[model samples]
Target: MISTSKHITVFEHQAIKLNQEIDGVLFDETRLKALQSYYGENGVPYYSLIHNGVRFNEYVGVIQVGETIIEVLPKADNSLKGSNEKKRWRDILIDMLFAVGIFDIHSPSNSSLKLKSNSILDLYFELFIKEVEYLLHNGLVKQYRKKEGNVTALKGNILFGKHIQQNITHQERFYSRYSTYDVEHNLHSILFKTIKLLKQINTNVELHSRIGALLLHFPEMPEIKVSESTFEKLVFNRKTQSYKKAIDISKLLLLKYHPDVSKGRNNVLALMFDMNKLWEQFVFISIRRHKEKQITITAQTSKYFWKPESGYRSKIRPDIVVNKDKADCVVLDTKWKNLNGYNPSPDDLRQMYVYHEYYNAKRVALIYPGTNTSKSSGIYLDPITSKEIDKECSVISLSVEPKIREWQKNIYETFNNWLTFGNDNVQKNKNASL
Candidate 1:
């Protein structure tokens, strides 16, 4: 058994900790190389590895090494009285889900499973098992092509081979696998397989046992060992989409570990998701989810700023774009930093200016995480020093706290206020409706 006492201390660079083993799901010297190669962090590594799984590009979260197991604690804490580690982790996961563009994944009325503090895997497992259960109960299946070669019978298509003798038959079956859409796909099957592996690594016997039970629930869903590059190539339609809706949580497990037959029982695989990019996506999704229907949220468009030098285009991509009637109206960017009563960084301001000029946006906005102590509501671009510009800029703070009850309403009000002046669609539609 891998020593439960082993601890690898490291730092979270850009909210990312590089794992030594891309597939083994452990911490070692290679992790340092990964850190140096990926993040260029030269100082002593400050992160602590508690177990096997893909080292996370987790949220503003910390991993604490325990005597028996590891603990994950989120940086965002609530003012709630009697709050424990479990509550903090729960709150953090909820915020992550929100930022991951699945805030409304489950409606308020239908939420059933409970959050536990014992293991972070519990949160992911519960979500995955529940979603798998939902898919099973859903009674809907999808079809896709599954190729096979067998001499048994002619099923899909026969590849006529000169090498095939009467006794030696190599019949390739190019048949559609009539399996359930959710079964053994890149997303769901990986979860099934990961869960099977988790049962082995889990220190919590009860939890792992439950995970084992959950695996049985997915009888038809064969556990698949798929690489990140390979699985990403599959497509899901409207029908299969619902079946694997739990993919977000499933992704956490898939990213953390991959099954390795070479290691036999120790087959673990995990991947990384940049929290910065994830947060950027979440901010836009939150805004888009609440914005007026007439207003369209264009995220990470391919359009980049270009200079006259050598016919090469500079790849400067803004985080979000608001379009009114198919015309770019506002250009916005989200910064994960806490400015702490200071003005937006000069570089950030300059970049926004470039976006405003390139996109011809009337207004540009910079959004940051809103904490209790620090507040920079927004400062409009001064008309005096804007350098004969056609657009104005503002820096806005969004709440990172998960417990805020009116968060969506807060997003709507903030975003709506920002665009009210420049968005002709909102103005045109507002008067007609209200």
Candidate 2:
């Protein structure tokens, strides 16, 4: 549709040929030596053939083997040359050769050296060829090729079709959407697009760390709120539940206390829940702007202690708890799953219920990733009423589609909002007045 056949031919004929030649030269020492002699005596030579006699900033060295001369070009570092130029001289040379059909080239996997073979000039040309191939294959090199009106329209339609396919594929690979490519486009476009989006967002987000952790903790459950009283009691009593104990308690509570609590995939759910909890903690800590908030985020002040209560003598370690600027505390328990669903499973609802009951929290929230169908729906049951609460507990979702940079900004904003809001609320009701 988009002239796939033509694109393939160009890449295969040019890029593939250059790649084969480079690969041959890398493996062969004789041709490498001949190329080395072409560089001249200084071990570095300005090549008008590439960037109009521009001095190549980086040199990989040269070697001579029998009748052949080999010139090796190392990876270019622009900072050393103090130039903002995007294309290296070597890259320019290769693109010119590629345009002239001198030799084809291809980029090695993992950003390694470009490969070439055949004649000495071909080998030298291969360097530029591989770079050009990288640009073309990656969709970074865009050339305006004139086409018939009918063909242009057809091409547009083809591109639209490819975009749809790409979107569908992205939905399938949620964690890796930033690194996929359609048959018509290269993966580099996806990465570049993602990077561009990130640039628009706030800078507070730890782009790499948060996203990496998010991917690591996919298919996460919603956030659960634990009550402040329950939290204090558990903390004071020195008894708590770990992830393992929480699952056992959940199964027992649902099966015995509430028959409606359906036993779903406990093992897989538990793993996801734990991983999500760990990731949330990591993300929260990673992007926290206030140094004073560190203790609360890390939950390091309270020593771990175990006590016998409600069947399991477990160490109840709240995911996060901190006492800053006030005698009251902030408590949060991480839930790793969807928060709202029609006929929501009993186990998930109960888990949050338990947290709220145990901790006497003024506000509890169930955080989740918003979906198309269930953006507004989340479990907000009241601890006192045992009925679905209207909005006592919030159900918030972190966006999955935000650019890495934007995501960071959101995280920073969220943290700032929480801090400002908490401080304002605290000031409104002072203990000194009481």
Candidate 3:
């Protein structure tokens, strides 16, 4: 049983037990039901309670929900061996950061730096706190003017209406003063709320201690849980370039944790991500870095006619579209799966075909994390009767080998080249140049 234990490790297909009462506290049935619905749609529950036992779903990482602590053992490989622990942590975090749109989260090849101490989440929280602290120590304060209402002094624009009612007694002696506290800044509030949030969800003693220490710097600030999207919209100009790190850290924190919703309205924290969409975005963005002239890459394009629907129909959003000279060149969709299916699962292949049909592209491909099981990296298939019979669809793989150690150049070169050469027009141009 996992109830008594503060933390437990489980591997794939492993079975444990969860009860209505765990750690001497009753569980919220609504959240469990919500998780059940999510798992059912996701296929392969992260944690399922059956007559057999509590099942560990396919995926690896840490899951902390309420008092229940789950430390899932990842699929161990050479990359995860003791010697490669640093790279293992770096790789996982880099990908997670990429998913959350935290591009260039660190500089000077910090991804290659070795960190031996904390778990992935704790490490992130620590780095984030430190980044904010760096900004604070450097005297980069976020300033904004607030409206005023008081009796002593009139600073900024005071409401004469408020003064007329409350300050009537001391009108000659005092005036309203609108003072924006030096300590109460927007960034400080974000950091304060994030730290308060980390305390609630995270159980690591060391991390808690570090967070408490950091909270001292933000002694007097309102605890406001702002919208996750607000962090990404933050802008820091040349004058306050120091706040760049804090803004970046804020984006990651918001991305990592979604505000918790359950029985009681007390705001808590739950961290999760749609790995598949993140992988798709990461692939698109990484390949985009090597973009050559005369070629363009657009992601999540909705211009094409995916279908003709009147009700209960949504426009299809292709993960990426590689274009040449304003024409649709190739349609690419990325899947987070390890490509273990019998043959590029028909569901995925059909979706690619639909993308090709709707967009009038020369080729369509589904990119999956290479597990080395598929013999060919770009396995193209043709010859099904259709309007664009000549067009090809392939299942391509980019090995997410957690072992690669570093984000080496050309990691996506093959895929990028595939996207470029996939266009018959570009190939013809290259041949003519030759």
- Per-residue lDDT tens digits for candidate 1, residues 11-92, read 2332323344221235544434333333224522333233332333344333322212223343332344334534654565
Estimate the overall C-alpha local distance difference test score of candidate 3: 0.56
Clashes of each: 16, 50, 6
Error of 1 at 11 (Å): 10
TM for candidate 2 is: 0.28
TM-score for candidate 1 = 0.62
lDDT of 2 by residue, 1-434 (tens): 12211101011001122112332232223222232334436643222122212232222222222222223332212232312121232333233233333333343331243232222222332233234234433443222323222221123223345445554555332211122122222122222222222232212222334334323322222233323332233321122111122222223222221111223211100001122433355335534533343444444223324565666565445555534333344454444444444433565445445544455444444444333212122435445865654223333445432233454456445544553463233333332211
Residue 201 miss distance in model 3 (angstroms): 4.6
lDDT of each: 0.53, 0.33, 0.56
Model 1: residues with Cα > 4 Å off, grouped in runs:
1-93, 99-110, 116-120, 138-192, 215-225, 232-243, 246-252, 258-273, 307-312, 324-328, 372-392, 400-405, 421-434
Candidate 3 TM-score to native: 0.68
**In candidate 3, what are the lDDT values of residues 134-210, reduced to their tens digit?**
66566657576464555354466566666677766775644455657465667667777777767676666656766
12 Cα displacement, candidate 3 (Å): 7.8
Candidate 2: minimum summed lDDT over ten consecutive residues — where? 4-13
Q: Is candidate 1 or candidate 3 better by lDDT?
A: 3
Sorted by lDDT, highest first, which candidate order results?
A: 3, 1, 2
- TM-score for each predicted model, relative to the true structure: 0.62, 0.28, 0.68
Worst 10 residues of 1 by lDDT: 61-70
lDDT of 2 at 326: 37
